[model samples]
Target: MSTAQRTAPAGADRTKHRKPPARRRPHRDQRWPASVFLSPWLIGVVALTLVPMAVSLYLSFTDYDLFSAPRWVGLRNYTDMLTEDPRFWRSVGTTVLYVVVAVPLKLGLALGVAMLLRSLVRGRAFYRSAFYAPSLLGASMSIALVWRALFNDGGSVTAVLDAVGLPADGWIGDPDLAVYVVVLLTVWQFGAPMVIFLAGLQQIPSTLYEAAAIDGAGRWRQFVSITVPMLSPVVFFNLVLEIINSFQVFTPAFVISGGNGGPADSTLFYTLYLYERGFTASHMGYAAAMAWLLLLAVGALTLILFRTARSWVFYADEEGR
Candidate 1:
């Protein structure tokens, strides 16, 4: 080879065989803005949520009344709960019944209302707003008071029962029926799930129903085969939410039952009982133990729902995959 060719810089060869560019990472400086925006949320979560939870967990293992420093009691609070506390078990059973009855009733009412709302041709927005107003109002203290009044012996509900020749009695004072009043109250606030069901219903194409009709499918058959499978995801979502919320129910029960879960403790929800222990009776350590147990129960139930959702929860986009 000529001296010129041999002496040529290796730059020419290096350029031809250069590797593809490495993927770029977000620059450290560029990440600062996002971190800055997230700092408040992170601080709130740590300071308000995580710290309180940690303190409560520690307190759960101790005997801490509000007036005195906590003394370590190991799992005595828990052991007492399982073996000694009849009220705790009663609260658990009442909370379970509330969840079982209220969730299905609420979801069923919401789904039924959603289907009716979906069929409207005019004033749909007005009807939606009207129906949603109850949920928007929420299970507030005033609402609970009003609910209690309405179920009182001389209230409107009793008046109606008397008019219909039905046994006229105040449900709030009836141990056998007081819990049902609470269930009805929860079911009344079904607008949130109803809106979700409505959204899911709207997403289903009319063509599916039309095709079903062409295939000689009845309305019930069309609903069973088409609407249900498509709406299963929304149903699952609402079911999980309702179950969680039901377990934590307290305000309505407290207000309606006069803060004692009264009339034989028929409306003694778990959270209400916890509140009575913590703040009312000054059993802070026991209450904290109850709270942690509640957290575990809710988490376990949520995990079970998620694990089982694979068998039923359908996502259209994931079908081909």
Candidate 2:
């Protein structure tokens, strides 16, 4: 056979021995498992949260008294809220004051306690439980009632003040001080942030402190320079959370004020007033408008916090400072 014929036969033998290319199956859907797990939550959001928000938004633009059909009022509800409402403004002021005072005090106390707890070696769990117990019941009706009794005339707080030779009066009855009393209760529930702060503290590297110590830096200097920088993100988180929570304070004010927002409306938190307008005064439309405005205010505040956080919040994983 010729050399060309011999080469052709060799190529044919090689081709016959080679395996055919494996057939490729279509790509399997990997997102199915996640979608399956998320379907219930999505359903809940649509059925429970989103639907109610949509209804409330619609009611905000109309006069919706529960007894009668909703009447289209255009922007009257919002206009009245801004121009003609005194109680609304008072509630706004009260809520703002409560948030301003309570959030900072709460965070400060939380951080202090967290720092103390981190150094504790014995009975640490017990102390943590005791410190955190209040947050569990802080906003409950029973706690509010207990706080009211404790601050009322001849109550425990009044008696203590009297014993200390200080001015003793019913804290819940004074218009100028009733809001502060609510703020005090909020500050007392610092446990949640305390626990969060404790977690953040634990996450901090001990090597940083040791290195600073080797450089002759005092504890305070290390705390200010290393600790604060690392924990800034946690502080920012707790601050935003506490601010949002403080704005929505209602049960305590409602229970303490006997559902009337009494004592000249000093303890009239915005949510309490919204509840009063919607249920007590039968002005559902006005209440809905108030609720929407509150949502907007909180959203704005949260947005501002996020925008400002870029300048202060530090993440360990970030590069290029």
Candidate 2 residue runs with Cα over 4 Å from true position? 1-37
Q: By lDDT, who's the top model here?
A: 1
lDDT of 1 by residue, 207-269 (tens): 999999999999899999999999999999999988998998888898878789988999898
The C-alpha lDDT values of all candidates are 0.89, 0.88
Model 1 lDDT at residue 299: 99
Instruction: List, residue by residue over 1-321, the lDDT tens digit for candidate 2.
Output: 588885455342245456333311111243577679999999999999999999999999999889999999999999999999999999999999889988999999999999999889888778888999999999798999998998888899989978998767877887887777788899999998999999999999899989999999998998899989999999999999989888998899998787888899988889999999999889899899999999999999999999999999988889566
